[model samples]
Target chain A: MSIDKLSGLRVLCVEDDPDIRAIAELALGDVGGFDVKLCASGAEALSVVDDFQPELVLLDVMMPGMDGPETLRALRAYESLQSTPVIFMTARLQPDEIKEYLALGAIDVIPKPFDPMTLGEQIGGILDRHSGTTGYR
Target chain B: MSVNDVQASLVALRSKFSGRAREEILFLSRQAEKMSEGKLTGAELSEAYHVLHRLAGSAGTFGLPDLGEAARVLEKSLKPHVERLAATGVADDAIAPVEPLFLRGIEGLFGLVTDQPASVPDSQNKTVEGVDDDSHGTQVRILVCHQSADVRLSLVQGLARYGFQCLEVSLTSPDLAGVIAESSRVASVFVVGEQQLEGVASECRSQNVGGRQLPVLCLAGHDSFEKRYWAAEAGAEGFFSEPLDFPRLADSIERLVSERRYRLSGRVLIVEDDSDLAEHYRLVLESSGVEVRLVSDTRHLMQDLAEFQPDIVLMDVNLAGRSGITLARLIRFEPRWLSLPIIYLSSEDDPESQLVAMSEGADEFLSKPITDDYLVRSVLHRCHRARQLSELMNRDSLTGLLKHALVKQQVHKELASCRRLGYRSCVAMVDLDHFKQVNDTWGHGCGDRVIKALANLLKNRLRETDVIGRYGGEEFVVVLPGCDVGQAQSVIEGIGRSFSELLFFGNDEDSFSVTLSAGIAALNDFSDGDVALEAADQALYQRKSAGRNGVSVYTVPE
Candidate 1:
């Protein structure tokens, strides 16, 4: 089944920096009503991703251990996660980098220094677009 | 958790990290003291860099802005020594330039190390994500993840003199190895610390599987054969040892990263009625690794474009029974070809003709009589810029595949061509099976790796005439012109089988693979591009519903 919105989705938010991770949690979990499980590094995310059974993975491109792309590569190895969508959230999501993520099967890229208040909408919009739905972008 | 609860946790967390930050800063200061007193060596310097880098990255976050700035200064001072150490495996001897600045940074940092401030500094009140305080703005960024602050500083300062942007990340960054592999902005990485050297080097190697691998240079304690051999085993491009040579190391770094990034390879399309001139132009460019395709007939320009898809077009302003300006304008009318550069080559060196050519969508006008060297350079540079700009506009950043909208336009163009000319063309919609599971099981990064692996495999295996594009999510659309249903299926099936067999590692140990489903719609079976695309989509849906990881061709119902 295709998912279209951020609400009620179990998400794995992977980032290296503690501050950024906390903010992402607040934006995704508290503000957007997402079930967000935060990881401090790509390695930690990899260790917990299968058990978490997250519907979506929100990754920070430049994380510590496995990095976003590496983590995505690792996740693809598991048969159970081959269909799950991954969205990259990074400060360095420039045009070229976004292409890199898209090539890696990232649903979309959310630029860094995001507005916490509207992150839910941005994420939802991308997911909705991904699932071929339209409404509250 | 509530936003308020998370915010409160963040506040409390800041203080906790602040305590550790102060201790780390104090220890880093002690290393600086030793370096100042001339006790610097390869091993000792590497450790200091690690501490200082951690301080620089964390101090600003833990409520000590001034300390972070000072660490930045000190890191800059050590840049040259760091680059030299990692590139050659030797810690190059360095005369600290602007020693007062390093001393000043050390003094300022001591204030923070000795006493934890009650309030966070205003300058770093926000996340360091947008902080732009560094003066090295013009240099190409060269990141140094080292163990010694002094070593990184010397290396950075030396690199700064040679126009390199220096960024320092902590030794504990899990993705330190990947920074070069993932980020295009990072020209190279200088790693000095001994701990995790092998792991970091391996990560660098792993990230470089598809694209240009980031050059990883390790800083070693000695120039021993055993040490170099170990470094090579760990996937380091080169190891710079202590008591190193700075200039030569700098040159080596440039040769490895910057010089390679700037290497020229392009395909130029030459449209000149003069067969001799076109071959001459093609020959000149071919020598420099630039592929050249010539079109002597003006009428077949569009057909050639659809086939070759060259980086830049070299056209004569005057064509046999046609105007070059008219052709250029027609090319620009199509959305897919909007940025396709058309350089007018004309013997009519008149300003009026050049102005007219420019107005009608020509990029450059080379006068009738031009030297081979000038023509080659002009064509190379134009093609290079066109490719770069095209990547920014038409290509997706990650896989370097054509964008969704751009792909659709390409599909339409290929369909129109098939309709006009009696040639068979196939539109194949490809989707990766269980792609989302790849994201959930490993992470987005792995999912991306699978996607990229598939994309690269497709590009490598498929013919150049086949236009491939990422049509969002795990879906891709390929326009295989001049190929029938059977031919397209055979080609796609081979690609799908090869892709699944390709090994994708989950970690140090776990490796897996993925498969793709292809649905082919013969253009001749449909009325238009959209209908053909829909037929392909329906075919894809049928395959997905009936167990995926296979190809199904669409057949017109009687």
Candidate 2:
């Protein structure tokens, strides 16, 4: 896969904490060099997913209203986003909990307190591996 | 955007987050109070849980790990309560039992937030400018002399991991002595093959770096008592037989470098009320480069301890009007001075009195009319042991850096000194980039090596007076006294660059390198050490956001 596969990629970040949301924007947009959009909550993400048509969605698992899995399900309801890769960013990464996230069709889970410096590369690697098998557009 | 702009934005965002977190904690406290008063319904309980859940998830990401962990514990504890309230409807009894628990959790969480040094608004004007470039000249250099090029290259590469820049010189060079003398200004340690040890040791013994003998480490092909004896006779401080254990060699080199960096003299506080005797003891200790403070009045013992911060105390059993045993007991009452070594001085050699002095927190009892040599030896040994014990207790075993609490205390102390002397100081938050990936990919052992390598780098590169601490796993807090933010940025940037170049070997031939990102904040800019450290952390996040392997100085956004 090309290294630039992640560059200029349209990514949506959904986090309730404004500080974390801003940091994610910088990580994905500035450091990762990806086209990024940030949404405060699952509701905000749902409202923007169709129009933005992001290539990837980075969802926070424990949001206040309409959490990550619920938001993923809601986004999957949109016909266009059914096969779109969604990565869950979470703090809780117990084995069983990770299984639950994967069962919900999340491409992978990037644990919280992530290295903002390499967030984009991490997402890119995950996408590269998943696309090899699933071949999602 | 420029890296500086991004860094500034990140700092602003962090302070904003701190402010918002404070408000959120306040709100949570109020909700807890409401629950205690039976005024909270199911909605409030759920809202409180969400607040805690948010804190648990986000606090660590913002560099508040303690807060995040505390919030996580409280959130986990409150999960069942929230679920029960949601499932059973508004039952007052269901919430009653959790009221106290919820309140205590809120208080603990609030303490974490408020413990952040209140941000001082006007201190921004005092940010120091014009940081001299020469101040960043403390990088450790090692001179390597070996017969084989392969051995030289391997040694250089291995030493580089410990942040030493190795200058390789051919062992057959006729000007070996001249090279040693010329490199004395830069090179701290000399490493040579066992075959070349005699020549290198003779040359290194004559060369000194900063008034100390250059340490020599010999790499031998085989281990033997004769070779060891030969190396020792030739003045080699360390002998490592191949295959070389780089970590062990690095540890020895680090210890030697630090010892050469600063040879701190012992400090003794004498509580002898006898004017003549106290003066005599002070003169005797001072002759051996030991700092001595004599207190004629026992009434000022506590004040003296606070001000002097002595390594050891010498108390005469008989004071002018008070008992020295009582004074020793008083010193032991304060937990901070409990580790201090106290020796009683008494003319009477009664075994019972000596036992009594030992019982009242005295470490040793010395009979009066002792020779000056005996006093110096006893006091110096006690002082050295006390310092070593204190360092062991206050240091992280893995990195040999100050533990988290001690680092924070050092920052506070530095800030106080900066404020008093009107000098600049900087607190830097340094974290290894993608450290978790290192652990997951190459096992915990390799990860530990990486952390240790970084610690060695920081210890070797920074000034001797700088206080370095392992704040958390793969996170370090460095307090740079008399350094402005700009100076710290350059120093830390150098470290970050060297750290990225270091390769850690995993199973098989897999080698990976990790980078570091550091954020620095001027101590004068923040109200207290915690706020200053937070600012530094915010700057660190900024560096991470702008890409890793760099340093960013925190600038207050206009």
Candidate 3:
């Protein structure tokens, strides 16, 4: 189950909370096995995305200065990051939230307080399903 | 220590260390279990999920490790169920056993903490959702049922901020429409909630609120996708969801407000053959803040337009033996006003003819019996755009008055007709007494204000059509169309008095007004406007040497 699912997977995590970032990084790295980069806010994520060239972005829905949806919209316009897999992790998503997020080109939504052990595996499954037959190489 | 004091202190220690946490945990556990049983519906499950998420966060903050762990588990279990229900529209009854597991865990921690254990009732109790009696007073005439109280309050506050007199009621009531009907002047109804659409619709119909339609906005709840879809079908106007995207909601409100359109403040020149219809247009347009000037004959059309420089032209399509469209084409051919927005206010219902009229240079082709909103919208849409262009052409930068060319073209025909009728019209030439001395003493800014102040004084005192123009430099001219020599002198005398009394500019210790020397001359013997104007100038020169702050009338008798 040690899928290099995100090994050199180039994942960027835009979360405000250090604890949440620690939780996400630990979950994504320890479980998902991706090269996860963490930024504190949407603004920082926008600034640093050029240096990272992240293939998959785990974006927090609510963050100070720019927020998640605004960042995603700005990110969509960039030629380099247009095809990146974006998964929204939000504490506030009602059941109907998935459709709106998916419509905005998010690969999937991960509800918060995600299982630290299976975070990478779940993201790997989603990437695998979307990339089609890649099977988390 | 006394025996009673020792016992009380020990009890206090037990309560502080253990009892409160245990009681709180047990109370929450029982409440959670009861809600989770058969009592909570799919929608309530969504609410319970949100409540538990907050509880879990708080429990971690309070160091209630076991209670936090149980809350976390409950939150996790509810998420998938809510999501699955949203996707498949099916609720799994199998998740019922997970409720007891969480309750047992929280209760076990409660037993360890407190001396007095809080008892958990095993039997299920029914929880009624959205059935709380509205504690909000009847003063809240218009009830808004947003999912959260803060959002509803913010919207209410915003509306109140903009001077929209309204009321806000509680969201806990199931019968939202019934609460809305209680207002005497429910000028509009806005329902913004995601519950009981049928009940809301019936209440709207049963109220029989005439003319003013209640605007209904349903804010979609998590489990109410069908309600969001069928809400407007149930007679609601706007459908939104939480976090309640205010800009989108505001746009919808703007449309509703536009539907009940605002009064248009504009000027319209109506050209019609029928005197009654012309008068009717005048009354309608004037009541809606439109300064209307009607010309019943085609002969007076150019004069009216030149004088009024109206924002929009409302012409009757069928004029005296000619179509209004032909007249509009003729107007469009003029280089000075090639882009005038002419609207044909006609009874013709044919779309092809309407198109033909528009092609003939009419901006709008409005049908007769136009609604107040349609009329206001049409006039405002055309006029507001035209005003931007006219501002450049009409404005005089120096004195902030209408330009000489524009004002002359306006007052010329009025002067001609008034002269012909033996209406005892008078022309006065007013010169600011020693104006160069003023410019030299007070600088140009003060001089400008003095000139502006005099113009304002004359405009404020005299009738609107009594034409006053800056006849170059400190000299001004006023054409009194219906005034004889005696009346003109009195009018100019009053102006001279008011002009000398006005406060111009003050520099700390001193403030002073400007004075004017004017000469008045009636056009009794003279027939031409230019010759009458020249005679008035000679009289003004005599008044200047005869000492300033006085009026002199021109007379041939010597």
lDDT (10s digit) by residue, model 2, range B1-558:
665565565556656767888898999999889878888877877898888877777775554555776777667656656776777775444455445655766777754552232111111111112111112235566778888888888887777656566777665667666556545544678888988888878766664422456788998998999999988998899998876767668877877876663354688998887776676666556644577888866777899889899999988888767888888888889998888889888886889867876988998888878887788788877887787787789889888899999999999999999988877888999999999998999899888888888888777666567899999999999988876676677777777776787666676466778999989999987778888888999999999999877888889878
Q: Quick one: best lDDT, which candidate?
A: 2
Question: Which of the predicted structures, 1 or 2, would earn the higher DockQ when compared with the native?
Answer: 2
Return the candidate ranking by lDDT, descending.
Answer: 2, 1, 3
Can you list each candidate's DockQ?
0.03, 0.11, 0.01
In terms of DockQ, the best-performing candidate is 2
Please tell me which predicted candidate would have the highest TM-score against the true structure. Answer: 2
Cα-based lDDT at residue B78, candidate 3:
61
Model 2 bad stretches (over 4 Å) = A1-137, B1-143, B149-188, B198-215, B221-248, B259-264, B414-425, B481-487, B522-525, B542-547, B552-558
Candidate 1, overall lDDT? Answer: 0.68
Scored against the true structure, residue B535 in model 3 reaches a CA lDDT of 82
- What lDDT does candidate 3 reach at residue B533? 70
Output the worst ten-in-a-row residue range by lDDT, candidate 3 chain B.
Answer: B125-134
Count clashing residue pairs per candidate.
81, 0, 5
True interface contacts reproduced by each model, as a fraction?
Answer: 0.04, 0.23, 0.00
lDDT of 3 by residue, B362-450 (tens): 87778997765577567776777787566556755544456666555434655677766645677888889888877887787767767
Q: Is the docking of candidate 2 incorrect, acceptable, medium or high quality?
A: incorrect
